[model samples]
Target: MTTARIYQRPKNAMQSGRARTDNWVLEFAPSEAKKADPLTGWAGSGDTRDQVRIGFPTQEAAVAYAEREGLAFTLFPAPERKLKLQAYADNFR
Candidate 1:
């Protein structure tokens, strides 16, 4: 199974609530290995294909980027898989 985590930049990291002019960033952490090679030696060292950072002009833009990149949107403490579950749970709910 593959798991992904998403995080948004805090307000203090931005400038005056302006995302375009400020630094609005998002990070995605992969919770699984990329390949099943036992001795390939491709783990950790920031090259494990398990981490990525993206910047945008606004929160909405960052969110759009996350969606486009197929990441789970958590938005700080609501829930880890809230967005992911909500996306599919609507059919059953």
Candidate 2:
């Protein structure tokens, strides 16, 4: 049986203003190990499913998709990050 991981999208500081973090993502764990390329020093796999990521508006939707696909899923809890709101002037203080 294949296992899938369902989790909430993380808030990225690089994409803070323009990014959407409300959605959840469903990702399938790679069934096979990746092979390393000696010459290029890169590792890759032919499994296209490894790169498949489906974004859902809610965690429930992500869970539903995993069930529909018959994939045993592990639900990763959403991480709570506390962000302190501060002004630019605070940095100078």
Candidate 3:
């Protein structure tokens, strides 16, 4: 089995107002029990070894690609958690 997630790169991560052409990235993570390299190049090392990716132009395109590829998809909201954490740390300082 594989899992997928989508994320809108934060403004700081983008070039201008336009989303990067490779904005949409599809990541496929294999079941942990398998403990093997993913078939696709998107796979990373360590705990996320069983992963693969496909890039797209837009969220819709990414969704369509995921559906066509018969892979599960998830959308990751912008990193509000990180910002919140930073704010909390600043308060303590």
Q: Pick the candidate with the highest lDDT.
A: 2
Task: Write the residue-wise lDDT of candidate 3 on 1-93 in tens digits.
Answer: 456787665555445553453376777665555334567646344656344566776888888987887878787654453333456568777
Model 1, CA-based lDDT: 0.54
Q: Poorest 10 consecutive residues of model 1 by lDDT?
A: 76-85
Q: Provide the global lDDT of candidate 2 against the true structure.
A: 0.87
Per-model C-alpha RMSD: 14.3, 2.4, 8.7
Assess candidate 3 and give its TM-score to the true structure.
Answer: 0.48
**Candidate number with greatest TM-score:** 2
Clashing pairs in 1: none
Q: Model 1 misses residue 90 by how many Å?
A: 56
**Ten contiguous residues with the weakest lDDT in model 2:** 11-20
Q: How close is candidate 2 to the true structure, as a TM-score?
A: 0.79
Candidate order by decreasing lDDT: 2, 3, 1
Residue 87 C-alpha lDDT in model 2:
95
TM-score of each: 0.40, 0.79, 0.48
Global fold similarity of model 1 (TM-score) = 0.40
**Steric collisions counted per model:** 0, 0, 1
Q: For model 2, name the residue pairs that clash.
A: none
